[model samples]
Target: MQGPARAVQPDEVLKDPQLETRARDLSKDLRCLVCQNQSIDDSDADLARDLRVLLRQRLVAGDSDAQAKQYLVDRYGDYVLLKPPFKTTTLVLWLGPLVLLLCGIWVAVGFYRRRGAAQGETEASIPLNEAEQKRLSKLLANERKR
Candidate 1:
């Protein structure tokens, strides 16, 4: 016996070639949330199966390829799409890495500045006044004569 209800085969889709192609293309780009890395077409999870059925129903109902995909997005949010659109809603998802990079640079700059300041302090020396220099030289000369 068959392992389970198998997918509608590509060969069997010859009756409606355009619909089959559209369904395939859309399913491949859509994600299976139940199986994170797997596309809707590839995953046999319940959610993926539901999406597959939904795709076929929409195709048969005369929704254009884009329209059907958009319909799913409307129901599930852009998270349903493999590559979610970049929008204000998704800005954090898209720009998270860049924000982290900028923060790291800011921290590094501050750390470097503080380290430099510490080094300057550690190596700092005060210059003597003219009177102090003269007194030091005279003391040295007196010691030498002794």
Candidate 2:
């Protein structure tokens, strides 16, 4: 079952189809401040509605799509963008996961290596068969006798 649909309201639709389409495309790239992960176009939160209306107003006011996006970025910072530009400020966001994965892989490799070495030592220390065990016992007995 799906949750209740929460998207653009009737009042939010632009009269111009082209402008509406553009607004929709732009909205998809914009993150809803309230929902964080959801695009404004997909959110029904009041803030999302406000952002949708603001976007349409910008388009109707003869702002280019880039200008409209930039205006929002200026107001909300790059967090408003779903795909924020790669920069020093967002370096962690882009690279943190990869670093974590590499660290995990390194740790796993080290653990396996240590485990294999321990197992190898354990195997080498054990007598392989009854004859080997008897030989080891004789060697120990001779050493004690000496």
Q: Which stretches in model 1 have alpha-carbon errors above 4 Å? A: 1-15, 105-146
Backbone clash tally (model 2) = 0
Tens-digit per-residue lDDT, 2-48, candidate 2:
22236989888887888988898899999999999999989989999
Error of 2 at 121 (Å): 2.6
TM-score of each: 0.62, 0.76
What lDDT is obtained when candidate 1 is compared to the true structure?
Answer: 0.81
Candidate 1 lDDT, 1-146, residue by residue in tens: 12222444443342576677777778889999898877887887877878888888888899998899999999999989998899999898899989999999999999999999998987676677899889999999999999
The whole-model lDDT of each prediction reads 0.81, 0.91
Which regions of candidate 2 deviate over 4 angstroms? Answer: 1-6, 126-146
Q: Which of the numbered candidates is closest to the native, going by highest TM-score?
A: 2
lDDT value, residue 64 of candidate 1 = 92
